[model samples]
Target: MTRFSANLGFLWQDRPLPDAIRAAKAAGFDAVECHWPYATAPGEVVAALAETGLPILGLNTRRGDIEAGENGLSALVGREDEARAAIDEALAYAAHVKAANVHVMAGFAQGQAAHRRFVAALRYACDQEAKRGISILIEPLNHYDAPGYFLATTDQAAEIIAEVGAPNLKLMFDCYHVQLMEGDLTHRLERLRPIIGHIQFAGVPDRGPPDAGEVSYAHVFKAIERLGYKAPLGAEYKPGGPTDDTLAWMAAYRP
Candidate 1:
């Protein structure tokens, strides 16, 4: 079976952390992850994992620590200091939770200077974060949902990862975004499997629960299994109903 990670950010937006983890486990999931565990302490995350015996697959670094009103940090951003600071804080959070990966958001930083700044920052982030035994997973956001985002396609992300040539840096293969940009799911997965550091998804176009959309994840997983992908398949979708309503998807999703 393909191990699955519930994305708490989308499923339990109003519930406590423990409740979310417990819910995932109750629904027969083995792990859980989220975008940001806002206001939730790192100890709480560790304790939740302990209580439910479920691992947190990963989470994002504090996007500007919100209280500081800082925007998200990505490699393509123009602010070197901000991007570096974001990486440092993310390293600490990962250490606290003993996480092996962090989704490094490369938000919009355009123009010649912005492009140059992003390239340099990516190199610095990988070099600095490698000390913790954790790697930076770069994601290319879609043009529709995240307009002006710097890294908007896997091809571009793969190019940058190849250029930086860091052992700790790799591309995050988000199915929804990739489907929107490229649509060749299985073939792309086969080609990019080597550089892929993490994978996530939502129903394409709508970003809702998989069963409620046009993207047939059952076939997708079957194809992924054909390639022998044994890692967690991340459930990073917006719940169409209650979080538990998504439990039915697992019944038909075979690896």
Candidate 2:
């Protein structure tokens, strides 16, 4: 069976944050991930991990306006200091959670300076994270979802990762966003799987649980496994209702 990581930030969100970690563990998930344990301190996140015994597969630097807007930090044009701060905070958080990867989102806005700054800031984070055994993930949010962002494709992210040339710096493979931005999922995954430090999903079109969504997770997960992907398949999606109810799709595939 494909190993799965559920994002507790979306599941059991109504409860106190740490309890969400326990909830994902209770759901039989192999790991728990989050976009932001923002208000939740590193001590708290680490404590939750200890109590639940769930590995934190990954997490992202704060985008700042996810509740009011959708543009992420890496989407910005010339705010390298901001990126550094965000990455530093996330790195500390990653350390506490013992997470392996931190997804970097370029802030949304257009300017050559932004691109340069983004790269410079990324290199800084990459250097620091390397010492801590964490891989810094550079994710390309789809243009529709984050217009004006500097990097918006796997190819672009690959270029930056190559330039940075750090073993700890890599791209995040988000199946839903990439499928929405560009198609040919399996072939693409095969082509870029090497630099991919993480993976995620949501059904295409509706971005719901895989059972009702457009992407054939059965096919996708099979392809991923065939490619020898060894990391958790990060379940980063909005719940259809509550977390457990949304995960009922996993039942149909029971062994």
Candidate that scores best on lDDT:
2
TM-scores of all candidate predictions against the true structure: 0.92, 0.92
Model 1 spans > 4 angstroms off: 65-71, 75-78
The regions of model 2 sitting more than 4 angstroms off are: 65-70, 74-78
Clashes of each: 2, 12
TM-score of 2: 0.92
lDDT (10s digit) by residue, model 2, range 85-134 = 88888898888779888887676766667767777778888889867999
Error of 2 at 181 (Å): 0.5
| lDDT values for all models | 0.78, 0.80
Residue 254 lDDT (model 1): 48
